[model samples]
Target: MPLDELPPPKVELSDDDWRARLTPEEFAVLRRAGTERPGVGEYTNTHTEGVYTCRACGAELFRSTEKFDSHCGWPSFFDPSHSDAVILRPDDSLGMRRVEVLCASCHSHLGHVFSGEGYPTPTDQRYCINSISLRLVPAED
Candidate 1:
């Protein structure tokens, strides 16, 4: 699809504003569309019960119940908090074809989703997300 055919950005901020709002690492990953090193994400081993929200826009992205270990070196969720909570776009960068997941509200690069790996998830798909793009809200007892 052409650039004109694409939807408008969810949230627009000046480069300086984005830089000020996010850390250097976050600005690189979310604004510049970079990826963190595998197995190095903060949420990779987090087993806490909570909802994960967008670090940039505080948009709820995933629920703890949907999380699972895919051993793919990232935070894996079987589903988003809601269908519209995240946006999936075709990413052919780096000479590879994959779906890029972004925060619907702030358009931050969360990560990628992969399928057909035969995970025990209900959707059988892994929503591999970046820890820097998410902030956990622990569930209250």
Candidate 2:
């Protein structure tokens, strides 16, 4: 469904439900706000055309067209599939400040977003997402 037409966040899962729905690695990043090691994410080097959806709720979050080679060791997108597909919040964890991006549907932690790094993308922003937190559905030919 289009983000604008989608209802508000309704995919609330309990800790046990999330653990049962996702693998341990996914649970770590998506449920616990943990960061996957840089350069090791499955989507870090992916160049295929697709819509990347939240692994937790299957909500469309980003598109390959907005993805760029930020070389940040994770899938990086300059924009989302829709402006409301994800929610951004102030994160001051780990002794620093950053923006935390979460799936709007399930409130699952996808990753962080950074801006003003001098990227050539139009938005000059990077949605640094974890591979295990997303599932890419390739676009039709």
Candidate 3:
């Protein structure tokens, strides 16, 4: 679909404000479609209990209970906390086919989704997310 045909981003941020709030690296991934180095994300080896929210808008996206290791060099989740919190787009970049995931609230590029995978989780869906796109909030003890 054309760019105009797709739904508008759920959240908006001023470039100056966002820059002041995030580092250069964070801004690139969250706002400029940049990817982090493999196995470098704090959540990749994390097994803590928390909720992952959008870095740009702080909208809840995924829960810690749903997180799993997909070995895809990014944070993976079996499912999102809510359906309406995210939006999927057909990505044809890099001469490959992939389903792009975005935060419904801010339209920030979260990651991609793949199906029919062998995951230890009950759900066969894999939401391969970029760590830079999320902020983890620890669950209450």
Candidate 4:
């Protein structure tokens, strides 16, 4: 779905400022690159039609149409809402090699994405995202 309005420009804030604006959990996931327990995210089983924006910066990231049940214990998207909405990077943390997904605007860690573990999506990729890293803005009726 197209965004209702343009994304509030790229966000740049200090650690203190970010901490002040987010809850502990949100801070962990968005700033500290922490992960929530599997299968316990708010958006994992959600079928609401809307756009998912960065919890910290309100930048549009994923759309409901891209969401699908990957049964991977997190919200999964076949692609981002826009190409420039997210930034991908190499993550070698936890002794595993993976591509990490981050909000392009705020550089907050959203999650990791994997490929070749196909689920019949157009992109042939699963953007495994954290629920706390996103805020759903339901579509208008």
Candidate 5:
């Protein structure tokens, strides 16, 4: 989608302020629409018990229980923790069409979701998330 077509992201941060708060890499992936190297994200191999929340705005997006190894070099989930926490947009970048996932609260780019996949879960959905887009909070006992 064209930059002008999509609704303006709900989250607003002053460029300088955001820059000061986030590292160059974080800002690139979170704000500047950049993608980290596949399989290099922190959560790709993370098997800890926790919830994955938006890094920009702590909205719960995924649970560890729904996470699976798609071997797609990203954190894949069969379903989101909550439906209202995410938004999907059609992304046509690099000459390929894909669905882009974003935080509904902050509009931070989370990743993409694909369908028609055989995953060991009820939903045959694969939410390929960027490791940089999430912060894992271990479940408290």
Candidate 6:
């Protein structure tokens, strides 16, 4: 769905609640803004039809229809299932500048987004995301 067509995120969580719900690795990446090792994420090579939801809050984030193979060592999405599902912020960490993507409902870091890198997609942008930050809900046939 388009940004204007998607519904708003309705779930919210406290820091302590999130920590309690997520595992150490999940908390590290989602809450602490840590990055997982490249090519090791669970969904890095998954091409199934489904919706990817926030691991921390189960809020819908990305859809399989928007995913593409960028061979970038992680899950890549050309566009979010809903524009309002992800929040982009300027990241100046690691001595570099990048746009960071996060779950709008729980404010968990999904990953970074890079644009104009020559990917042939509708948005010309790559949402480089971590599998740890997302939970796949496969579409019912």
What's the lDDT of the predicted structure labeled candidate 5? 0.85
Encode model 3's per-residue lDDT on 101-137: one tens digit a residue: 8788877778889988777787899998888888899
Off by over 4 Å in 4: 1-9
The candidate with the higher TM-score, 1 or 6, is 1
Candidate 5: stretches off by over 4 Å: 1-10
Clashes of each: 0, 0, 3, 0, 0, 0
Off by over 4 Å in 6: 1-10
lDDT of 6 at 136: 98
Mark the regions of model 3 whose C-alpha exceeds 4 Å error after superposition: 1-3
Clashing pairs in 1: none
In the order shown, the candidates' Cα RMSDs to the true structure are 1.5, 4.5, 1.7, 5.8, 1.8, 4.9
lDDT string for model 4 (1-141, tens) is 112233543788988999999999999999999999999999999999999999999999999999999999999999999999998878888999899998989888899999999689999999999999999999999
TM-scores of all predicted structures: 0.93, 0.92, 0.90, 0.92, 0.89, 0.91
Residue 71 shift from truth in candidate 4, angstroms:
0.5
Q: Tell me the whole-model lDDT of each prediction, alpha carbons only.
A: 0.88, 0.90, 0.85, 0.92, 0.85, 0.89
Q: Model 5, poorest ten-residue lDDT window?
A: 1-10
Residue 119 local lDDT, model 1: 98
lDDT of 2 by residue, 1-141 (tens): 333443557798789999999999999999889999999988999999999999999999999999898888999999999988998888888899899898988888999999999999999899999998999999999
Give the poorly placed runs of model 2, Cα more than 4 Å off.
Answer: 1-8
**Residue 39 Cα positional deviation in candidate 5, in Å, after optimal superposition:** 2.0
Q: What is the lDDT, from 0 to 100, of the residue 60 in candidate 5?
A: 92
State the weakest 10-residue window (summed lDDT) of model 2. 1-10
lDDT-better candidate, 3 vs 4: 4
Clashes of 5: 0
In model 5, pairs of residues that clash are none
